[model samples]
Target: MTLTLPPAPHGGPRAGRHLVDAALWPDVARLPRASALRTAVARRIVERAVRRLPLRVRTPGAAAPALPRQPRGSADGLPTLILHDPGAFFRRIGADGLIGFGESYMAGEWDGDDLVGVLTVLAGHVDDLVPQALRRLRGAWVHRRPASDRNTVDGARRNVHRHYDLSNELFATFLDPTLTYSSAVFASLPAGAEDLSAAQHRKIDRLLDLAGTGPGTTLLEIGTGWGELAVRAARRGARVRTVTLSREQRDLALRRVAEAGLRDRVTVELCDYRRVDGTYDAVVSVEMIEAVGAAYWPAYFGALHRLLAPGGRAVLQAITMPHERMLHTARTHTWISKYVFPGGLVPSREAIARHSAAAGLSLVHDTGYGEHYAETLRLWRERFLGRSAEVSALGFDHVFRRMWELYLAYSEAGFRSRYLDVRQLVLTGRTTADRGTG
Candidate 1:
């Protein structure tokens, strides 16, 4: 059955005042004394971050935005700050810290002339922006990834639905023609030395190469993202079985596969990785592990280990964070986990190695390109803003649009600041990695 989407309320239920009332303002109104204290401590650190940030501020075209205490500076590449409700902005941050900061944008409290540049500065100093002593208190003030969002087959379905199933049209407004959702590895940058679709193809081909996929190979793809990779694999004469829990994605992917004339070779189905039984020459998952909650890391990797044929490689494209940061932030649920991706966690390289090793997989090769992600985000944000009207036409409202604007900027900043990274890792059995490939 094809699912029909209702038009967005301005931008949809995920946006507008409903979102603020349901998610943001509650965090505001219910700032307990304990949380406020933490927010206060957080404020001290953020104030320091702001003071030391190499930022330049100026009136927009000799006219400042309708806000007070705006900083004035020259034409350096620094981001220009614009504030609407300074007190509410700080209050939001005081209560929820990072989540509040993003909510402030959604609530029209502040903005930047160059949102990405401003966020990049903040993301760069994120580690230092919060006092070290606060790590001990994080457990006291933060909400953990909700138990309901767990990666049990049923739980995973709900979590994935919250984000991916929102509306394909919503995503279509931003993503390039390929409908590929992961980071695109570009070759160069001048006037489009590499476009998004091209970069996506490069990223997929590189992973397939790592897996040694070839004509007549049997391949298992853990996450079927709109079917681009599966289509490409089938085009190479590889038989592919790709699984996803997202009904919306599965339906569209099936259509795209058939449209490309590869239905015989590529099979897209709705299935859980744990229940999937197969032995394949190659296995690949792209940026799917983030959605795999921390508790399920063992099963997630073990499935790969069990599925790979002798000497067969598994290539996974995953987003990673610093080891220490990962540990510090792992137990705490922040804005991204709550709003963007429920039950999602970005693992550190150390965590990935530790868990994969425990699950009988060994990492043989790995590559990271955070800057490429930043570039990709920059393009997506620009494209979305360009199509802002079209997005509204799809039923998204003002609040939803601004929320996404901040979401994109927040992510771009993470990569620019070196706070986050994306990597493709080639793995095999420890024994296989130790021996030369046959």
Candidate 2:
């Protein structure tokens, strides 16, 4: 049934209301609610997990018993989690597991002093949080992704618009002045030491360099992120064609290209990567592979293989997870999928190699910089928090703020704990014979 919400106050849906797709309504309506017994069990499991970690948990009342403390270390201090409403927190966890945990935070049931650090400890111990017997029955607890979230041509557009089109103004508030939205290749441990713009340029330059883009080089960018990469490539004397599903991004990118006086050199199209045509001397897509759900990984790689001219090289920056974890969570719907990026999955390094190889591309170079991503998220989260008033002025509510905070902090934790990574991959053409023999 269609959820006929009163149209949003503005032109588009509000921050948390993006799940307005009629096809997704049924799934939302059917979300499971935990029983009292299940809630009690979940509380015990959470308490057990908390006890094993180097974290501090404070309950609601002054007389309430707090969690055990950890010894001082080189780190700033022990991370702290304060459960403002312990009952709601555990009930949500029992109902939706991790997804509920995020909702509980958004509902102001809990908070963390060092959100990223606390989340990192939790991420590091994800495997041991639950007992072996319970782990085997994960299917009973975890919510599978609904079929409506699949990245079909039409579905992909909806998913992309849901996040990317949330308002360019909103993204600009957190992203660097350049509006680059992916991990930057920082020259230092902390991101802001050399300025984010320089680091972003370094990352883009590295990808272009690996693709051998130069004067008269024809470059095809699969994901046009505000035209930063295209502008940089055009400045390198390469004619660039970039594609994106975001109308907001395409319009802004075109204006940026025009402002740079590179309109003749750069073309930004509102199109999907799968539908892009014509061969190019080089291809570069930054951190886009993660959005191409695992079911479409083969098609995504095949598009790259089909789009490259003979001897042409392609460069991709991808966010990845361990193979086992990727496999285990590939179809599980979690907090990120529910509240932030929909219809996306982080691919594993092994999955990247296997899929790219099968698509007749040889992996020439691969580099992982997960720590850089951690630093990048820290910068973004801080910037976003600093501009909370502006974010609210733009129409997002308190719940939206908390949700975005959890999303960014949760992502940073994934990288900090080494549960996730960002990788730059360089691919070269392979002969049909080579693929067949392999």
Candidate 3:
């Protein structure tokens, strides 16, 4: 059923005073104190780890009572780390490990002269931060994925609501006019904010092209992100059916489809992909696989295989990590998983290939554009920071803003350091004759 919602003032939900009470926006001001021994150990480990890296860790007035001796690292031409509250930083890291590091930043305990650069250097050396002996015992100390973040149907809906159902104005402040939340494949390596809309269209068109979308073609989109892809497909003369779990996205997407006068050609449903039933000439899902969770990857791939008609194709744009790294951290919960996108895990290219092949889908084409994602995030971060007042007016506090800023910068650094990737993949069904060879 098409659920109708009264449009907000600007074609979205009422933005102001809605997100301040969001569950993800945790209060960072009140935290449990760490024992003195734990704090001392954390401070020592942090100082030793950063000592040989390209970082300049310092406190105000050249010295402070909390941090008596500043570490002398390879600081020439490196990013400077300014510690506002050294005691809090130590306590947080000592207690929560990496999650605490991110929380410390959100709590205003530290600031960096070059946020992305600092994160990039740290990301490059992430696997080496701890000693080999301690690394082997990570499972004992690291946070485990919570049972609630399991990505079951109910859990998935709740997780999606936690992030995507936040005020739409919050996303509109940073994203392009189309409201695309994924990475844009730009024609040039680094495009300006003015070019983001065109880049997003370009990205969508490429996926459509891979899907062979055209007149009279039946296109099914697994993720309906603001209805831009549906509108574009409808304009190309294709019949489009797109589904999303987000109510906010569905409401705005329906409004956008109407605004474009393509309501007859496009159908937007507030449904999950697994619940949709149809045979289409093409299926396209952009950057949605990350939220499928590793355990459900096979089910996700099987759904794509089952929904395609004869000679049909499925295209996906996914954020990926190294296969070994993905396996190592598959069950571990990090700050991003906790604060930004719950129940999310980026799959590896190999994992995608293996899962789809098992589901009778043949991998056809794969393209990586991590640099484009890096550039895309840089533009978003700058735009988001520039519009701080507007974001604040939307009822988000400084801690929420800091957490979001850190999320963007952390992701950008992952791409910049080659620790993360974004890829486009095309898959086709396997014929009975072809299935015998494997």
Candidate 4:
């Protein structure tokens, strides 16, 4: 699987610089062909990658026809889009790999016209190249373990630390000031009309609306990031209690609550949701269900149901996939699970509905806002890129910057393309009185 860099078209030093890196150079130098033949092999690998993508993905729009030839020419004299040092990188990512490719991107061993697009293409056609069924079996075997309080708590903290603990300063560079880390809700708004901040505000408003929050109501938020919703609900006259695993989030959220003069009405706890025990008029969990593994969905939902008063309503915003079970070789899922969000798994809509029902909660309303999430990620990506220097200054090197960029952009594409979806579900206990349904 060795691949050597073809000599630059004109034998220029700059052209061969990418291949000179120690990590990749050995494989390139030992490639079993002359430079011309190696170039052809590289083109073939790229073509194979393209072919692995689903047909619809390869041709995103009707106007964009499928590329029939490899090494499509570039008018600007740029290098052809080939996986230089593919063998080395691929070997590094061998057998149940996801984070390695992201690291390689950071190391400048690969280049793409569009990294997000490349990921989307890869994800769409992932089944073609990978043994998905066997991979899932192996992953399940590897992850199978008796559940324990320590394991659950550790998993929760690991996820929180991976994403939320990346440094509040760095997060502020991309996320809105409110720091709502979940999907945003865009209601009655024109497509692409609202910015990330506005969209998140709308999402908070929507959650409050779903919960019927108002004067004299007591609300509880699980996995409350930055406490924006808690503060907002409290301002609306509802007493809010929020739980979070990230110390950073709890600290910032508490400060925000104090600054807003709602400290009396809002309380942020640095603890796992499973440890919290209280009844509220409304209970909301945003973007946290994914961290509750599929094996624990029943218990997770039951906890949510128990936290709500008999007549209380609960709203949840979570990412959902189309499959009945989790995919194994899903590179995006794998990447997030390993590097971005440890122990995260996107449940399918059926799984959520069934689990809610099993927990004595009726799904009164379910709305798909997957595209809005795509839009939200796009805004975050742009903002992150705009603040690249600031992010780099926060102890993140070039590789870290590329990782975050790829994360934001490819996430956006996944949501937009319907490969991933976000759903806001309004659940009410069976004993709850029916309110005006939306």
Find the candidate with the highest TM-score and give its number: 2
Model 3, 1-438: lDDT tens digits are 111111112222221223334454453554445786766666766666676566566665543222223345433466767766666677677777778888778877678899898899789878887777667657644689898998899999999999999989999999989899999888877574348898889999999999999999999999898989999999999999999999999999999999999999999998877888978989999999999999999889999988888788999999999898898778788898999889999999999999999998999899999999999899899989999999999988877898999999999999999999999999998454543343
lDDT by residue (1-438, candidate 4, tens digit) is: 222233322422222335434443343222222244433433444445444333211211123334433334423322123344444344334422444455545445456666566666565545554444444444421222223312276766876676788798998998888887777766544445656677788888988998999999999998878889998899899998999888888899999999999989998998777788878899989888887877678878988888888788989998988773354422234555655666667888888888999988899998887877877777788889999999978978665676678778768777765778998889988464543321
User: How accurate locally, in lDDT, is each candidate?
Assistant: 0.78, 0.84, 0.83, 0.68
lDDT of 2 by residue, 194-303 (tens): 89889989988999999998999999999998999999999999999999999999999999999999999999998889999988989999989988999999999999
User: Residue by residue across 152-257, what tens digits does model 1's lDDT show?
Assistant: 8898999999889888898999999999988888887532756789898998899888888889999999989899999999988899999999999999999999
TM-score of each: 0.86, 0.90, 0.89, 0.78
lDDT: worst 10-residue window of model 2: 1-10
Runs in model 1 deviating more than 4 A are 1-44, 56-77, 132-141, 190-193, 430-438
- Clashes in model 2: which pairs? none
lDDT score, candidate 3, position 264 = 95
Evaluated against the true structure, the overall lDDT of model 4 is: 0.68
Q: What is the lDDT of candidate 3?
A: 0.83
The lDDT-based order of candidates, best leading, equals 2, 3, 1, 4
Of 3 and 4, the candidate ranking higher by TM-score: 3
Off by over 4 Å in 3: 1-27, 63-76, 192-194, 430-438
Candidate 2 residue 262 C-alpha distance from true site, Å:
0.5
State which candidate, 1 or 3, has the greater lDDT: 3
Which regions of candidate 2 are displaced past 4 Å?
A: 1-32, 64-66, 69-76, 430-438
At residue 73, candidate 4 shows an lDDT of 46
